[model samples]
Target: MTDTTVLEQTQLPIGDWEFPRLEPRGYVEPRNRILKRTGYYGGPVKGAPSTSRQVEVLNQGILESPMQFEGLLSGVETLSKTPSVNDQFQAYALGLVDSPNVVEAGDVGVGKSTLMKCDYVLRALTLLRRRVVVVDKKQQSPTEPWGEYTNVAHTAGVDPIRLALGDRDGSRINMLDPALSQTRFIAGDTGALMVLQQAAALLNDGTPLDTWERKALRAALRDGAAQARARGRVVNIYDVLDHCGVISDELTRQMSPTALERMHEAGLTLRFILERLPEEMPGLFDGETSENVKLGEKLTVFDISQLPEDGPAVPLAMMLANAWTLGTIRRSEPGWKTTFCVDEGWFLVGGPMGKVIQSNAKLSRALGLSNVVNIHHISDIPADDPAVAFIKEAGTMHLFRQSKADDAVAAAQIAGLKPGAAEQLMTLPKGQHFKKVGLAAEVRIAHFRSELERQITDTSAGLTGAAL
Candidate 1:
C-alpha cells in the first residue's frame, strides 16, 4: 500500500474541533481541576482586571489613624505608608508600625538596611518622642549614609554623638562603672551578687560562671559594695578584684578547704581575664564613662566604626551599650517610647552577648522598649544559637533580596514564609522586599524614601557622586 494511504487509515478521522472544544482524542478533564471556563474554583474570575486584587485589599480597609488609640498610643509610633511593589492598579495600605521588635535580613546593597534605618530611626526620634541608641558599624567614611544621617539628626535638635575608639574627647562607656554596677544590684546583697555574676559573665563572654567562681565573685562584690558604701565612692571592677585578691579570713574559715582552694584559683583566673581585656582593648572600656555620654533628647550612636570588624571589641561594646541604654531607660519616667537599634547586629546576636540581647528582647515590650535588629543572612546565625529564638519572636520581619539559595531558604523558614517565597527571594530585584507582620500574609513593598531621606541614607555617595 502507498505511504499516504497507510497513514490516513491508521490516524483518527478528522473532526471540526476548535477553541473551547479543542482536545486530543483521548484527553480527559479531571473533576478536581481548579481553573474552569467561568473562573477559578476558589479565587477571582479568569481574565479579571488587575484592579481586582487592589479592590479586594482596599475593601479590608486602610490603616486606622494613630489618634484612634488615644491614651494607649503613648509609645505608638507612625511610619511612612508602605507602598505596594507595583502600581498596576492601586497600592496596598500598611498601618503605622507599633510592633515591639522588627527584624530585617538581606544581602548587601539590597536596601533593607537603609529602609529600617531611615524609617524606624526617623519615626522613633521625631514622631514617637523616644530616645534612640544605635550601634553603627557601617559608616566607613564621611559621606556614608549613617554619617550623613548624623548630620540630619544634628539639625533636627537630635545631636548625633559618635563614640569611637581612641577618641578621648568622645563618648566612653565604663563597663566597670560603680553606678552601672549598682543598677544591677537589686535587693541589697542579692542584687550585689547579681552584679558580680554579670561582671563574671561579661569577662567570660557570657558563658555561665563556675560554682566556685560565682561564689568567690559574689563574696567579693558583696564585700566591695559595702566598703564602697562606707567610703561614699562607687564600687568599680578593681575594688571587686581587690576584695577577691584577699579573701577575708573569716569568710575563708566558713568554707571547706577544697572549696577555699577552688575560690582561690577562680579568683586568679577572673582577675587575669579582666586585667587583660583593658590591655588588649585599650580606649573603649578601660576608664570612667565620658562626661559627654548622655542620652538626652538625641540619637546616641555607639560609633564603633573605627574598631576592627572581626575583633572582640565590637561585641563587647554592643553589650556595654545595651546595658547602659537599658539602665538609662529604666531610670527615665514610665510611658516613654524608646527604640534600640543594632546595625550589623551579628556582633550583638551571633557573639557571646547573644544571650544578653535575647533576654533584653523578651522584656522589651514590658519595658516600653523597641528592638530593631538587622543582619545580612539568616544562615550566618547558628541554628541552635540563642539569636534564632530572638529572630523568630520578632513581630515584624522585612525579608530583602537574598543572594544565596541557602540564605533565602533559611530566611523563609525563620519568617514562616509561603513555600514559593524561597524561589521569589532568588529573583527579587534590589530595593524590593517581602515584609511580614505577625501572622499576616507577606506584602511586597517598594520602599519609598524622600529626597532628604535619600541624601541622608545614600551609602554609595562616593561612587554615585551624590552630595549631602
Candidate 2:
C-alpha cells in the first residue's frame, strides 16, 4: 500500500537587487572585447583566404573555448554594470548545445537579427572557425557576416570562400577560381542551367521559342542529359538565341529609340532575361545541382536575388528542403555534423522548405547538425510548422518583440501571455522586450545593442547601398 503524500505550496520569490555590488575591475583581463568598429551587420571579410582542396568538414568551428565563452558573457555584464547574467546566458547556451537551436523574438526594431549577428553568433563563429551556411531570403547585405565568412575562414587558416551568387554553370559545378574554390552556393534554379544553354543554342540556331516552347525548355533545365538528348528538339528560346545572338554591348549602347521596342517585341519578358542568364558569370541562376558535392575548391554563392518578384518565402522553403537533403545525403558518414543557420524561419516553415527542414529536424540532432532558424513574425509561423518541432525539441529560444498586429497576436499566444499584452510587447519601447526562455521561463527585460549594430540593422532607413 502506498502512503498518500501532502504537497507543500511555496510562494514564488521576488527580490530587489539588494545584494552588495561586487567591486568592478580586478577580476580578469578584459575578455569580452568588441572587435568590430561598425555595429551594422556585415558578412564575412573578403579576400581572407584561399583553399586548394575540397574540405570534408568533419567538425564544426572553434572560435571560442567553452570556458572563455563563459568568461566573455560575464564581461558583458561588467560592461553594462548589470547584475551577473552569466548564469542566465550559460543556461541558454547550455540548452542550445544540448538541443542546438534557439528562436530570437520581439518587435520589428528590437534587434533580433542584430543580436544574433553581433551579441553571440559572430564571436562564436570566430572561436569555432566553423564553416557557416547562411540561408537568408532577404538581400545579402554587404555588411553581414555571410559574405565575409570566407575571409574569416581564410584568416583562420581554413580555406573559406564565398561563391558569386550564380557560381554554378549549366553543369551545376560551382564555378570559381582555383584560389577561391572554398565556397558552395546551393539555392535555386541550378537545374535551369542547361535549359538556358539550350535556349541560347536555339537562339544561336535562329529558332524562336513561344511560351509552350519555353515550358519544354524548362524540362531541359533540369538535366544536362535531357538537354543533350534534344538533338532536333523543337527549336525554342535556345534556338532563337543561337540564331539572333545576344545583342552586342555596342549594339545595346547604340540601340535606337525603336530598338528597345523591338527587343521587348522579341518576347523579352523579365523571366526570359533571367532564363537566358549568364553562362560564364558567377551569381544567381547559373545552373543545376550536381549529383556530387563540393567538387573543387570554389566557394560558390547562388544568387537568386533575381528570382521572380514573387515572395521568395515559398521558393526559399523549397530550396532549403532540397539543399540540406542533398548535402546531407552526400555527407552522411560518421563524424559529419553540418551546422545550418537559417534566417527567416517563419516563412519557410509554412511554405516549401517546411518539409525539407522537418524531415531532417529530428535526424539532424543526432547527426550533430544544429539548425538555428530566424523569423520576422510569429504569425508567419504556421501552427504545425515542422520547424516548431525542432524549435520545441531543441528547447531554447530568444524571443524578441513584434510590432505588426497579426504578429503580435501570434507572439502573444506562443509566449502564453495575455493577448492584449502581446500588442504592447510587440510595440515595446526601444531597448525593452519580453524574452521567453524555451517553454519553461519568461522574462521581460530591457535590451541594448551597440550603436553601430543599430544603424546597419535599421530596416526603416532602407538599405544604404548594394548588399553582397
Candidate 3:
C-alpha cells in the first residue's frame, strides 16, 4: 500500500484533535539514508569568524611540574613557588639522598656560613634535638679575639673550647690520648697510630711518611701506649716522642742492620718533630685532652681561629677535635644523632687529614653522624687531590654565588649540575643558592631568615662593624 493511503486509514481523532496527514514520497532503503546523515556531521566544524574574534592568542610554552621538599628544617622558597625544606639528615631519612653528608660551596659573604649556622646547626639542635660539633675557623673579628661561633656556642649553653698558639692557658688535646683509641670506628692502638701519622704528615709540610718512617712511628706509638698503660696513665705526644728512638726486640726481627739504622734515624726525626711542636705551637697537642674539651652539651665549638693560617696548627687541631668527637659519639649509645660541621673545611680536608675525613664520611651513617663541609671554592683544591673525592661523596650540595667564573664552573661540575647552572652560580644573589639533593633536579632557593636568626647567624659583623 502507498504511504498516503496507510496514513489516512490509520489517522484517528480524540477530543477534536486528529493526527496530521503524512506527505507521500518515494521509498529508499534505510542504509542509504543512514550513510547520508553520517557524512554531513562527520566533516570538520568551521573556525570562528574573523569579526567574532575578541581575545589575543597566548602562545607561550607550558611550564614544568613544581618541585617539592619536606622536612623539619627552616623553610626555603623556590623559584617554582614550592618550599624547599630539608636538612641533610631529613633528606636522607626520606630516601631523597643516599648519604647524609653535605658540602656547601660559595664565595665569601654569600651566606654559606650563615645558612650553615642557622639552618643546619641551630635548627637541627632546637627543632630536631640533634647534637652538633663545629670546627669553627673564622674569627669573630680582628679585634674580638675569638671564633665567630663563640656567641652561638654560648647561646646553646656551652663555652667555645678555645685553642691558641703560644698561649699557655689555652686548651690542650693530647695527640696520643687513650680516648682517641676507645671508639668503635677505630679500636685500640689503631686510632692513636692514625693520629700520630696525621700529625707527622702535617708537620712535614703535607709530605707523607716513608715506609721506614711509618714503621718507626708505629713501633713508637705501640711502645708508648703500652708503657703509658703500665704507668697507670694515658699516653701523650711527649711519651710517644720519648719512645721513638728506643729499638725493641720486635725491631730486630723486622729489619736488617742497615734497615734498623734507617729506622732509628726516622724515629729520631719524628721525635725531633714532636719535641719542637711545644715550642712552635705551645699548649696544643702537648698534654692530655683538656677537661674543658668535653662534649657535654648539644653544641661544641672548637675555636681554632687564633692559629696561623699558613701553619699546620689549624688542621692539627681540627683533626684532634674530629677524632675526639668521633670517639665520644662511638662510645655513646646508639640512636643519638650528631651533626659534624667544619667551616673553612679546606683546612680539614687537605693533606693527610683528608683521608681521616673521607674515612669518617664513609662511616658517618653507621655512627649516626651527618657530616657538613663548608668551603669557599672547589677550584681552590686541585682536581687530583683526595679532598676532591670527599667533596664528591657528599650526596647533598648547596651552591651559592661564586665570584670567579672558573670557581662557579668547578662547583657546578662537581655538583653535577646542568650546562646553564654554572652561569646561574655566577649571578646568584646573596641568600639565594642552587640546592642539589642527590640525583634529583637542582632547585634555585631563596633562604629566608627571621630577625632573631639574622642576628645570631651574622658573619658580616667583622666587615660591617655591627654589634654582635
Q: Which ten residues in a row have the lowest lDDT in candidate 3?
A: 11-20
Alpha-carbon error at 100 in model 1, in Å? 2.2
Model 3, 328-436: lDDT tens per residue? Answer: 7877766778888987887754566677788888998888888888888899898777789888989889998997999999998889998899987888887778888
Residue-by-residue lDDT tens digits, candidate 1, 400-464: 88978999999999889998898888777666678776676676655555556666666666566
Q: Which stretches of candidate 2 lie over 4 Å from their true place?
A: 1-98, 140-303, 311-338, 380-394, 404-406, 417-424, 445-468
Return the TM-score for each candidate structure: 0.71, 0.47, 0.79
**Better lDDT candidate (1, 3):** 3
- RMSD values, in order shown: 16.4, 20.3, 18.9
Clashes of 2: 81
Candidate 2 lDDT by residue in tens digits, 1-468: 322343443321221112223343333323222433363334666556645543446454544222213422311221222332222234444663445555666655555665554434443444332333444344435454243233323333433222233433312322211111111222334423333433343323333455534543343333333343476332222333332323435545867858645544443442344343344233332333343324221122222333333433235323533343335434445543344555555556554456556655655555444555666666766567775565555544555667677777776666566446765665565544454445544444444444444443444323555332
> What stretches of model 1 exceed 4 Å from their correct place?
1-99, 142-149, 152-165, 176-196, 205-207, 226-231, 252-262, 295-298, 461-468
Name the better of 1 and 2 by lDDT: 1
TM-score of 2: 0.47
